[model samples]
Target chain A: MSGTAPEMGRRDGSFEREPARRVFASELRECRYQFKDGEDEKSPTFVLLPTGERSNRIFIVGTLTEKTRQGEQNIFYRGRVIDPTGTFFIMAGSYQPEAMQQLAKIETPAFVAVIGKPNLYQKPDGSYLASVRVEAITVVDKDTRDLWVLDTAAHTLDRVDALATSTSPDIVKAKEQYPSVDPAVYRKMAYDALAQIKM
Target chain B: MDYSEVTERISRKFSKSGKEIDRQKVEGKLRRLIDEFGVQPSEAERSVSNELAKEFNIPAAGSSGGTGAGAGGATEQKAIAQAQPGDWVTLEGKVVSLAAPASPAIAQSGIIADESGGIRFVVWAKSNALKMKEGAWYRIESAVVDEYKNIPNLKVHSGTTITEIEKTDPLIPEPSPIRDLRPGIGSVRAKVIQEWEVTHDRMLQSGLLGDETGTVKFVIWKEPGKEKLAVGTVYSVFYAQVDEYNERLSLNITTATIMQEEGDIVTATGGDVEIRGAIVHIAPGSGIIKRCPVPGCNRALSRQNYCPIHEIQPNFVYDLRIKGWLDDGEKTHNILLKRDVVEALTGINLDQAKEIAENNPLGMDEVFLQMRDKVLGRYVACKGREIENRLLVNTCERMHFESGEHAKLLNRAGGAP
Candidate 1:
């Protein structure tokens, strides 16, 4: 604190980059924690994804339910993917031409999967606005979309169980990051997603 | 043993021809000298005789000022800081630092000190000196304390006697803060903030360590079956070989070195650190360099073209490297990206780097330029050890997001960039 030297908190760079995540648009918007040191560090914006798991990266596979342009020049393309429970927004800029061109060919209401990074912004009211900066977007079959739902629901349930019961320090840390954690809505989402197959 | 005999002796001494002897005064003086003064009996005999000689008008036999002893006669204790120039002094302390012989005449040059302070000392080869060990206290007698450029040092020659003393260790300085660390501290302690695999003559775990004052890159020499230092642990490291690279100090952890995890023993954790900054400049030694093709000796072969192990006739392999400076609004860290990591960042494989070098007249300089175009003025997130000012890059990537992305976005877990 006396300008002694660099502090260790600023240089903890290796944490939370090990796995990408799968989350929902509503949960992304609801979550609010952004940890960064400076421009040189990839500050992991901590969030509780829809599957009730806490992570920094998220992977989504849903239906290409809607597509629209926000900017007047049409340089920015924003699309909505519908998973069983919630919508995941996929944004592709002019820089991501391959993903943009791929999205243009797909018709509305088709099953599509997207891998992207979560962009988090803290609102003035202390809530966070969340979106995904799409790295790759692909059209998949109905079966592929269903399989994703099953896998994602299982992951979300496993996380929910861990959060509700486990006292491991890492889970404790995740809980601290998102203080008012509620996993019941995601548990319900998981149950509702499974009912469509009705096995 | 007999008070009557002692009284008779004092009375006899007082019975000189011209002196008026007061028997009471003679016994009274002897009583105070023996009882009150706590003088040794043999020494008290001499004092009483002298006292009687002075009192009864006989001249004393010896001068009373106790200045008879000199160096080597009776041991003289002096702090290293108190030793004056041209004084034959006795120094009782431990060796703090020792320099191996640079020439034939000087056997060793080192630091010696006691609780007071320290001074440089030289042991001459012809002094037929005993091998002085570090961290051991010894009493050095009859040594000439000399001054050079106003700095004092003990110059020991053949006449000096060095005897190992029976006592606790002389206090050695604690591992200095990272910022205060300079060349010549034989050992130190710091938290292992970053640890990763590196090549010396073989594959080993090396990374940056630091205290509040500063940081240094340390390499643990690979021992086939030994445990390695874990990240996030603090250790008191001994005899790490010191070196200077590009004016910044570095250390090598050898097999004989001792490292104990002193988790709470140290004041600073050399806390969680990283360089979040934009590339401001590209350092030299970037681009392609020839590495030794020898299985374990992957050291960068110097331009004179020799590997320390394989010498003269050597096989070479191509490796890509990147060195640059990153300014994180506050501090600037020198970063090095080696081989595959460099390829991942620059998008130029080793072959491509070589081809680009050969095609251009500037050769390696052109390759440096291309890398500069990709990196300079751009933000980067580098994970690695920050020793001295250099960031030994383990995993690094462009920092385009205002907030951190999923770890998978940059590929692989990060280290000191």
Candidate 2:
């Protein structure tokens, strides 16, 4: 619902809607660092993107590979969405009842576009696992998926470009946090993601 | 109940055993068995938890509610950076900075950073927690991570504990480079490269600053006792607010303190870049177009002569521009050609384009069609500044093909061994 139209939406005076970032599943999986900007409890939780940006929400179009109803008392759905690069784990619970219902009804192997929050949880051993807390998931066409691939590739490469050129705070912080990740690697991933689309 | 909680609780069973286990993977395995294999939920949980315990060589918890590890449901002690939105984490960090409470319910709120990174923390007045002073170290236990504006902040409540500690050296954020400056208060030391004519009445001085990384345009507004910066002198500007305009980064130093420094900074010069590519596609709104006549609001008008902001303008100024895309094989760059570049590319100046639009039965679209036919798929080298993926083309010329290179390619294809 948040990403159906590209036009900017203002919810109210106090609540500013977080723009959903378009990133490849490959890049999204590597996102471990999470932060928030304001002090309000309702402020969105943003994940620090490796290429150099803070993403509160992510907009991705992928093929729904599998789905499973995970909960019993309060049912939630776990959906596996795969893009050109990798798989994005999606979890929709009672908190997002509509998304959960939508995920439950949708058949597998369908092209799906999702706009959701990036959620991360740390293991006791210190490694972090990332997934998307589904806000909205809609079945889409192959053309939409392809368009998203091209657009996401461009955005990913733009961030890769900013990693070196722009000294923006988020870029600087991303560089500091993810020092081992080479910017060229993301460039290659973007190219690889783009190659999946047939013009 | 969320299955994630069940999976996480099961995951805690292995935390003290020092065996690595993915919580989501456990949830996935459990879900697959129950949803796909049609096993009972209790059986699925038991089997999955047992499988993980056996794989890691730890004793299995008999039931889903049982805690296998000796830690026995204790909250995880974590670094400030590792804490997630919902987790109850015990963090040992110093009170780096404190701000005035936004509401009466909040007793204290500030940033707490360890060696990893910094996080904002808030102590609720209802919690009756001990007051924390800035620059002092405290061990905050059982604090919940609350998210706001996509950032994680610490919530100190009645359940949380705070203790003073003597820890040395938390990671202090360094003054970011000009390139690293986002839309926030930042400090930078750089040489004033060029000063521009003050365009606005409130603008005291505006110019370009350069350091080793890159150059940024800066504006010092007219304020009481504000000093003008001399060109070619290096100044250390502290707490300057960084803002963006038209995809380019600029600095506003109205409330900042400036001190001239001794070192001469070698500024990275030359913003012009030449990109050789084929004009892949011509975007809409190319060739002849009408713009709002209002100064500083030169937005293109709709087909009905309605400006988005100004609304229904009777008189509009004609402008010549080409919005297109250029693909240099690997990536496609958005290209914008203004009146000058459009004239050079299509041999149709603004006046000619206006005449064509006015006379043609097809109206303004005829000029667009002609321009598209002339430039689409044409191999050209455009020289300009690349800002936010758009190349503002200053100079444009058709790329010349080298005969020798073409001959070599032909030979390789026709006469190869």
Candidate 3:
């Protein structure tokens, strides 16, 4: 069998699936993508979205890529964390003081789990970057990594299917028609419905 | 759903597809497709699926292979050059010289040459002995690029690492020095030969002399030197500094430098003539003045005949002060009166003018009018230091009366002095 067979079995859940687990490496390389969280506070946050998110509240597992300096007193850390998909950066702020403290103690490649929003940061020089601010982190092993890859792959494929069918204006029209639909909910429903369509 | 199952599924799907797709490209395409389709997936569901597909490079069921390939290619082509911080690069160039070493510690950075091109670089006092063996090639690494005179140059900072390379090719030829060395240490020197004192405190004196490099301005000091040296006299200057100001380089002899009449006359060699055109603007208080209460105090008296300081009678003095235009047909300059020169030329005590102005409102106007003819359009030989646009001539001696015949003669001689 080709190396691609295992990837197919996991996508279809041909193998056993378990709760997502975190995988840590000596140096998890990742991009730092910035976003704002909370409506009022709108804190600048970074999210390390696992290369794939196929399950609800998908567990994003990686080690804190950046080191938090205890003496520096500043909240910015520069490091990369990795998962099965790819590597991404973790820029933790004061809101994530607990994560920061935990990160300071752990050595590079320590395992972690993050639950936060994902965002893209566009620079003036016309570059798009990806990053995450971890809401939580937990250690896990290879068994967990396998499960995450399967779940994330399924959801990602579903989104791609949804996008191929709908026109750009149809999405805009839906938003206008469903005035009461919360934007986040409407986006999810639209994508899921599109994903369900038969190719 | 377990993350391992998700990765396995993703891995299995891509493994079977026989085509590789980057997770990021898949995520972007999925997001755009969802937006285009008006399909709303729950945040959790959408995020989870997108993450899995993006991480595992799983193509959505409906995604056309052609479209995916095109998008992936476009994304890959857009990748920018990424460099980690603290990386170092090298810059090399030829040297461009400007001012000479006035003070031994002066560090001037000029041009350097490389096969690519020439760029400006500075060598410090510590690096002053960097053996710039004109034309030899040297390479400096980790030097950051900076702008000087709106031109980019390599700047060597503390973090900068430098390496010098020996000349493999022939030595680089040096450009000719801009000015000749005269009155420098161990060189023949001369003093002011003839001078014309202008109403303004400046004076211009010129004479014949010769050194290895030939005759040049020697003792052009402020307010004209106390005693002018006679012609045919040579002086020896122990130490003199050369400086470039306003693109003209000249020598400056300090008091510590030796100056004495040697009685030996040296013939002059014709050199490049230096000429400057200045604009003089006269304001309200610029004419012949009455010395107020003391020699230094320039305050005028009030109508009540009371001086600001003394409030009583004091001696008055007069001097030549100008309040008119000096036009050289090319530029117009407003000239002001130097108080001492005003006193010397007018023979009226400055203090007396203050006293008269105290009683008469038109007194200053009358005095300024009398000096206007002596100043306007008249040519004066000037030797001075320049600060910005204003020339502070140490001596301003009026050379020629303004007349058509004189103007004709000057024009005929190409305005030579």
By summed lDDT, the worst window of 10 consecutive residues in model 3 chain B runs over: B74-83
TM-score of each: 0.39, 0.40, 0.25
Candidate 1 residues B309-388, lDDT tens each? 78853557778888765554224566778887788887888898889877889887778767755655455678866544
Tens-digit lDDT track of model 2 for B1-417: 246865765665466566668877888887788778988654575578668867876544433222323322335778776877766678888776566688998999877767655677889886677799888998876566756654576888654667788877744444567877755445688899877656555678888888888878899877678889999999888656567654567887765657798979788756668887556456667889898886546678999999887898879999999887665533456678888899998999989988999899998989987886577545578997765446778898976544353343333323312
Per-residue accuracy of model 3 over B1-417 as CA lDDT, tens digit each:
223333333343355445454545445544554565544322322344445545557544223222323223111111001111121235444342322333554365544554333444554443323445454566554343434333444544332334566656632322112235411122335544433231122322323234534444444333323344555555664323333444334444432134575455434433422222211223334565544545434455543445666665456544435432232322333334466655544454577556655566777765653343233222344444332233334445544223343233323323212
Q: Sort the candidates on lDDT, descending order.
A: 2, 1, 3
Q: Which residue runs of candidate 2 sit more than 4 Å off their true CA positions?
A: A1-199, B1-117, B120-142, B146-172, B176-274, B292-298, B313-318, B328-332, B349-361, B384-394, B407-415
* Fnat measured on candidate 1: 0.00
The residue ranges of model 1 lying beyond 4 angstroms of the native Cα positions read: A1-199, B1-69, B72-76, B79-89, B94-102, B108-121, B128-137, B142-154, B158-285, B294-314, B325-334, B349-373, B383-389, B401-417
Q: Each model's RMSD to truth, in Å?
A: 19.4, 22.7, 38.3
Q: Report per-candidate DockQ.
A: 0.02, 0.02, 0.00
Better of 1 and 3 by TM-score: 1
